[model samples]
Target: MKPLVWIVALAVLSYSTISGMVGHDHHVLIIAGATDGYLSPCGCVKPMSGGLRRRVTAIKQLSVPNMTTVIETGGFVKDSGRQDQMKAEAIAETMKLVKVAAINYGLEEARLGAGMAASLDRLSGEALVATGLGGGAIPVKKFKVSGPFLIGGIDPRIEQIGAALGSKLEPIDESVRALTDEAKESKLVPVLMTRGDLESAEAIAKKHPSLRLIVCSVKSSPYDAPRRVGDTLIVTPGEHAKYVVRIEWDGQAFTAYRFFDLGPEYADDKQAQEVYTAYLARVTSEDLLSMVPRSETDVFAGSAACAPCHAAEQRVWKASAHSKALATLEKEGHDRDPDCTGCHVVGLRSVNGFRSRAITPNLTDVGCESCHGPSKLHAMNPTKHKLAKVGKESCMPCHNTEHSPTFDFDAYWAKIKH
Candidate 1:
C-alpha cells in the first residue's frame, strides 16, 4: 500500500513539473504586422486614423511586462525612390524599438527585385526576415508563450522573389506535416506565418490541425473576425496598421484573442516621431526635387498662369485648400519632401509637368493644370486649347481612399467649381 502511494505521488509531481516547464501564468503573443506599406496614415484627411507612432504607443501599453513577442510580416514602399527607401528604413527602425521578433517577406517585399530587398534586410538588421527555407532556425523564437517554436513562409505567388531572397520553396502540406512532426518530437509549439491567401492557409490547416495558429497576410480585405480552419484559428492584422491582434496564452494554448483598434484615442510615441522626422530629413537630403528639363508633352503652367485667363476659377482655387497644399507641407517642414510635394505640386512628377523649384517654380501647388491636364501648349494658345473631358479617374491619382478617404467628387468639386 505504501509503495503504491509513493508511485502515485511521484507521477503527480512529474506531471506538475512538465506543466511548469511548458506553461507560464501570463504569456502574451502580440501578432503584429504591416502587410502593405501603410507605415503612416494618409494625412490628406484630418484626424488621421492610423500611424506607426500611435501604434507604437498601443504596443508599449500592451507589452507592459516585457513578456511579449512582436512579429512584422511583409509590407512594401508605394514609391521605390531613395526617399521611399528612407521611409521603409525608418519603419524598420521603429519596429526594432518595439522589439519585434521577426518579419516575413511577402509579394510586395519580393517585388522590390531581390537587390532592394537585400538592401532593406541589411538596413533592418536582417531581423526583417525569418526564413526557414534558406537555412533559418526551425523555431524563430524560444519564447514559451506559445510553446518554443515558430515557422514562417513566403507566398508561392512570389516564389521567384523568395528564391532570390534565398528562401526555398516546397509543398505546403508536406512542409507542414514534416515541420509538425519535428516540433512535436522537440516539444515545441508550431505556429505558421505565411504571406499566402486564405485558400492556401485553409488547405494547410485542414491537413495539420495541430498547428497553434496560422497568421495570414492579407491585402484586399482583412478578416473582421477569426475563422477556424480545421482545428487552427486563422487571423490577420487588418491593413494600414488600423488594428493589432493582441493574443493571450495560458502557456498551453491561446486563452483570449483581443484585437485593438488603433484610432484617434491613442497618442503618438515621441520617440517614433523622431525616427520618422529623421527619415523625412533623409528625403530632404536626397534632393529628389532637383530641377529637371520639361518635356514636349506640356509644361505645368501654374494656377497663376490660368488666373489671367479664368479669374473666377483662379479665385475659387486660391480660396481652396489645393492652392495652399504646398504651404501646408512647408509648415510641417516637408516642403521639399519628394513624397508629399509630388501630390501637392502641379505636375511635380507627372508627364512633362512641374520638375522643380529652380526651373518650374510657378508649378508649385495644385493648380488648374493639375486636373485640367498639362496646358503648356494650350496656355500659349487658349482658342486652340481643348480638353476632352474631366473625370473622377483623373482626380484619383492623389485623392484616392488611402490618402483622401473622405474625398467626394461632388463635395470637393463644388468647393472649387468655377
Candidate 2:
C-alpha cells in the first residue's frame, strides 16, 4: 500500500508540472491603431495620442511570461519628409525597447510615397522580427502558443498616394503564406493582421484551415464582431480604437477578455462623451495654438476665429499646449532660422526672407486655414461652402527633420507648459 501511494503521488506531481508547462492556457494581448509616427491635426509638432513612449509603457504593463505577442496595426507615418523618417526611426527604437513582435503598414505609409515606405519597411525589418498572420515565427497554419503572446507587422492596404505612385503592393495571401511557413518552425502561435485587405485575409483562412487570425482596421464595422471565419477569430476593436483583446488559450480551447477604450464610463457615469469632447477641445486648442499662430494669420487665426463662436472650446484651448508652442520656438531661436521658421512661425514660407506680412492677413501664422483649406466661404455661411479639413499628408512640408533635429512628438508636446 505504501509503494502504491508513492507511485500515485509521483504521477500526480508529473502531471501537474506538465500541465503548468504546456497546458497552462495562453494570454494574448492585441493592440490596435498604433500610429506612433503619424501626425494629427490636434497638433503637428506633438502627437496627441498613439506615441511610442505611451505604447512602450502600456506593453510593459501588459506583458507576462508565458508567451507575449505585441501586434502594431500600422498607420505609422506622419509626413514624407526626412523628419518623418526620423520619427519612424524613433518608433523603431521604441519598438525595440518594447520588444514588439510585428507591425502592419497603415494608409499613412502609402501617403508617404513608395520610397519613404520602402525606407521605413527596411528600417522596421532590420530592427524587429516581422511576425504576423503570415510573416513571423508562428505561421498562420497550425500555430499554437502556451501563454503571453505578442505579434506585429501585417499591413496590406497601400495608401492612395502609394497606389498612385505605382508601389508594388504585397498581396495579403503572399504575406500570409510567409507567416504560416515561419510559424511552423517557431514556438509562437496565434497570428495577428491589421484592417483593410479583408479579401486577402479571408482567402488565406480559407486555404489554411488550422490557423487563428485577429483582424484590426480603422473602419471596422460592429457587424464583424467576434465571428469565426474559416478557423479565424475575426475580432474588431470597434469605434473605440484603444482596446485590448486578452485571450487565454487553454489546452483544449481558447477564451478571450475584451477590454475596450470606453474612457471612464466603467465608473457608471454618462459623462464619458462630455469628458472626451472637453478633453479634445482642450488638447486641440492648447497644444495646437501653442505651435501655430493664434490671433494673426498663419495657423492661429482660424482656430482663434472659431473660438469666439465656440466659447467653450476657446476656454479649453486657452489651457492647452498649442497656445504655447510658438513661444517655445521663439525662446529656442528657432523663429530666427529660415529652415525652422516654416514650422515655427506658421505661414513663414520657404522663400528667401519670407515675411509674415507678405501673405494674407489670415495666413500670417499657422491657423485653421493652413490645414483645413480656405475657410473664408465656410465662415461666411456655416453651411453653404464646404469646409475641407487638411489630410494627414499636408503636415510633412514643414514637420520633417530637414528643418531641425529637435522636431519630435514627445519633446515638442512636453514643451507646452500650459
Candidate 3:
C-alpha cells in the first residue's frame, strides 16, 4: 500500500510539470528608439555609449530562440537632408537585418515627407508603422507569437506641425480605437509605441485602457525602470540608442524587465561595421562637409597668435586634451565626419573655420579661438578688439548633457584655468 501511494504521487508531479511547460510560452520584447542617426559613438570621448554595431551585438545576445521580438519607438534622424536620407537607409538595413517586428515613425521621419518615408519603409522590409499621419505605413502590425501580438504607433507632434510639413493629419483617437478594436476581436495583446515621453503615453493609457503595454520615448534617462498604470506597462527605451530595454512576458503579464547599456562590453558586429563604413564613404563622396552651411563670422587667428600674448594659457591648452581633440577623431577614423568635426575643431560653422587638416591646419583641434570668439582682429589690434569674457557657457557648445554627461564646470575649469 505504501509503494502504490508513492507511485501515484510521482505520476501526479510529472503530469503537472509537463502541463506547465506546454501552457506557458515565455517571450522577450526588446525595445530600442531615438537613434537620431547615430550609427556609432565618436571614440573621441571616454565612456561613450551607443551605435548600431553595438546594438546588434546586444540583440544577438539578449534574443531567445523564437521568443524575441524587437521594436523601435522612432526618430531615425535629426533632420531631413541628403545625409539624413542616407542615414535612414543605413538604419533601415540594420533594423531589418535584426528582424525588428515594428518601427514607429517619429517627427524626423515625418519631416522626410510621405514619399521618402514610404521608400524607407520598403527598404526596411515594411517594418515601419505610423498612426494619425499615415501614408504607406500600416496602422497596426501583427506579430505571431504564442497568442498573437498587435502593435501600433502614434505621434502627437504630427498634427501640430502638419502645416509646416505639408502632411495630412488624421485623428489620433480614431487610430487608437481601431487598433484597440482589432486586437480585441482577434484576442491579441495590444501594444502602442509613442515618441512623446511619459505624460503623453499616460494620457493615452487613460483614454485607451485596452492597451496592455505602451513603449514610450522619454526626455529623462533611458535607464528609467518600467512603470505600471493600472494594467498598462510603460517602458522607455532611452534616447540616441544609448540603451535597449527588454521586457519578459509569460503569455500573460510582464514577468521581468532590464535595460541593456550599449557600452564597451559588447563586441561590434561585422555587418554593422560594414554599414557604418559605407555611410562614411558616402559622406566623403558627396563632399557633405564642404556643403555644410556656414555663416560669415569673425576670422580665427589660430592658437599660434594666442601663444605670443598668453604663453601660460597656450601651455595649459596644449597639456589638456583640447590640443589633441582632432587626433582623437583621427584615431577613430571619423576625422572627415562633419557631425563630429564641429565639436573637435575650431569654428566649424564659420567660413574661416576648419575645413580639412590640409586646408586649416592651425584650426585642426579645439583652438583658443574656439571659445574666445575668434580673436583674429584681437590678435591684430588688442586695443580695438577687446575679447569677450568667457564663462561656463563657453564650454556648453561641446560639453552639453549628450556629449559630456559627467561634465562639472568648476572641476573641468580647474584643469585649464588660465
**lDDT, model 1, position 218:** 70
Question: In terms of lDDT, which candidate is stronger, 1 or 2?
Answer: 1
lDDT of 2 by residue, 53-165 (tens): 33444455445654555555555554554444544554554554545555555555545554554555454543222232223222121122324332434555434533545
Model 3 CA lDDT for position 149: 70
- Pick out the ten consecutive residues of candidate 3 with the lowest summed lDDT: 138-147
lDDT of 3 at 312: 91
- Which sequence of candidate numbers ranks them by TM-score, best first? 3, 1, 2
The weakest ten consecutive residues by lDDT in model 1 span 137-146
In model 2, the Cα lDDT at residue 320 comes to: 58
Of the candidates shown, which would achieve the greatest TM-score relative to the real structure? 3
What residue pairs are clashing in model 1?
none
Q: Which stretches of candidate 2 lie over 4 Å from their true place?
A: 1-23, 36-50, 105-171, 181-192, 195-204, 220-225, 236-245, 251-253, 260-325, 328-418
Which is the better candidate, 1 or 3, if ranked by lDDT?
Answer: 3
Best by lDDT: 3
> For model 3, how does the per-residue alpha-carbon lDDT over 1-418 read when each residue is reduced to its tens digit?
6743543454345324422343347777788878888878866456577889888877776666577788888788988898898888888878877788888876787677667766777877777777665542333232322325788888878665465456565677887887788789988888888877788888989999988899888655554467878888898888788778877777788756767677766678888788878888888788788888999998999888889888999999999999999998888767777878899999899998989989888998989988888888999999998999889999999998778888999999998898
lDDT by residue (tens digit), candidate 1, 229-333: 756888887666766776655657665565666666668899888887887677677766654333456565666777777888888888998888878888876
Clash counts per candidate, in order, are 0, 58, 0
